[model samples]
Target: MAYVLWEFTILGFDPTSFMFSGALIAFSWLLVNNRMMDTEALGRDQLFYATHDPVILMDAAGRFAGANLAARDLFGDEIPEHGGSLRQLNKIGPMLDCLAATGELNPAESISVGDRVYDPRALPIASPIQRRNNLLGWTVSLVDITERERSAEALREALSRAEAANRAKSEFLAVVSHELRTPMTSLKGSLDLMFNGVAGDVSDRMKELLGIARRNSVRLQKLIDDILDLQKLDLNTLNFELQDVEPTEFLREVMRDCEMHAAQAKVRLSVVSDDAEGRMHVDPYRLKQVVGNVLSNAVKFSPEGGNIECSLGATGDALRMSIRDSGPGIPENAEDKVFGRFNQVDSSSTRASGGSGLGMHIAKILIERMGGAISYQSRLGVGSVFHIDIPLAGGVPRQSSPPCDSVPGDGEGVPAFGEVRG
Candidate 1:
């Protein structure tokens, strides 16, 4: 961030006054440099002076009234001590007129005199009356902004180059991932056929090796698919076919897809879904992708013979389906990091789960794009529950979104798994 972006202050000489360091100086914000001046009333209350910056005073007649020592040094002969008017100061005059005309001084319109540029800030000294508002000349402050503009321009250029590089990288990844998919699918199929004795009978040792190869090929294919999806998401090119879907029906269909994986992990699956018809606008494919990632994670982490429960209900106006897993729960502080790309709680090489850590990150983004959100709550010795919330079609958006991490056994908004809701 730029220094100007910070809410900063140049300490005023007098402790009683506030200086406008990071904002425009209106009538109430005129602070002087505390240096006494012979400019009479114009410099009496320290209103026409600056310690380092140039501050100028012009009479209501548009003639230069007075300038402080700094302003004198900066403008030199252009200070117009010979009663020259505001219209004679070359660029500064027109800039002031343009600013007053538009009621805005664009940063790009700063006065560039020789090698230095300055942002001209002006405020009309005035007094209100019954008939007509009175104008008491003007106070114009010239703030040197050469370095600030240069730094901003450089930062903008750097950002442009970085974005171009990132886009190219995403394009390359998408192409390579697509190309690798066909060969990976063939490799996995061939391994399966060979293990099944398609090329004559295979020994037990040969079968074991083929199993390892096949499993790895499957893993590799998943990585490729995830990378491609991630690229599409980053490029904002992924299309979703959104349609109204009934809540319970959607969960049942997704359950079937996760059934085989859950069974292989020696885990039981159950649903406590609302049988009543309800509508949720969502992209079926994207929603499935989200549920699949969460379900797969649950399966990988569940203890053998453990149970994973899926529930569908209305969490406010939105439909929420929470998937609870009977695994060692995540730490309470791990909420934010859980959805961060390429991040993992157990990052050690000996960690049990194997993944590129892009699943939850991509899932979070996809769910959000569908006017929904994903959240979780966990207890160390108990388990973790992932709450996937999506707004019902044509329904009001959720307001005053409460905290997502509900305390289990605390009798809160939603109860923990194994605890029935009334």
Candidate 2:
């Protein structure tokens, strides 16, 4: 009977047996939690694998430690399960070259992998696990910039073609100018003889008609001369004699010379200088051309009896000169085009304005050559203002500054010349 009770007791659910069963259940729950954490970590790694940019980790001994999805996709099954293949390393040849040269590579570098050309970069990193040892190595990254490289190459090719075309056009213009000038010169001489009665005297009506013809011929000749001058400037053959010039005196002389033209247009032209006396370091003749072009435009654009203002001042180590005109102002949209060659505003004003359409372009080129800048502003139906800013030389005097003991004198000044040789 005692033995039978003992066997039954062992089979029954006692306190000790219940406690052991509860401990087992707790341990199982802990195991489930641990598995959940591990799954979450694996999911994060998988997410990194799907990115397009190739990522690779290598040890100090150049052994591949790990690779992302992109690296695997590129190498396929060829990449070893442990250390990467030499073929994989050689794939980014250009990237390696850039790294060798610059100690780092950027995404802008050109590279190739397999049959595909890739613009990629390789970045070197110190071993994270053991900095002084080969336990962990560096990480290399690559990005495909093939599209960017293609676009850049295409742009370079297009630029080359455009430059070739521009050179050809410039050559053609220069040849045409030379050919045209020879015949025009002959025509002008013939007209001069006829006008002077060298050929024969003519009746009153005939002479009047002949005078009109001569005037139109003169205007045509002027246009041709402007074209020739523009061509010379383009070809960089415009001979300039450089010298020191007094700004106040130079402005006065330019206004005086342009007085006749301004009077003919019935516009008042004047100069206002910040200093009564100051000198400039430049090619005086070329500077005169720049100023003359501005003055002529101002005079032509100003309404009759309206004010034409030319003001000069100092601006941040530069001499600033502005020519302002009171006329039907420039159209806002067409302002930029005005600086381009042969470009004029499409209006009655531009048509009525007699010019070879090279004045502003030539002026801009000349000013830029002199280490200066020219810009303009205009409002429709109001007025237009053109500003020139030129850097001052070391010896140049300011408004209230003292002058040097030595005053520069004109030596072999620019040759005497008339307007357009008409």
Report the C-alpha lDDT of model 2 over 1-422, residue by residue, as the tens digit. 33355643446544566667899999999999999999999898886687787777655455667889898898666556676443345555334444444555544655677655665645566545664643344567667666777788899999999988977777788788778888888887887788788899977887787788776776777667667778787778877666667667777888898898789789888654446334566788878778888788888777788667676665555676667677776766564466678776653563676665667777788888887777766665666667666556544435432111111121222211111100
Positional deviation of residue 382's Cα in model 1 after best superposition, in angstroms: 0.8
Clash pairs, model 1 backbone: none
Best by TM-score: 1
Q: Give the per-residue Cα lDDT of candidate 2 at 140.
A: 71
For candidate 1, the lDDT comes to 0.76
What lDDT does candidate 2 reach at residue 386? 73
- Please report, in order, the local distance difference test score of every candidate based on alpha carbons: 0.76, 0.66
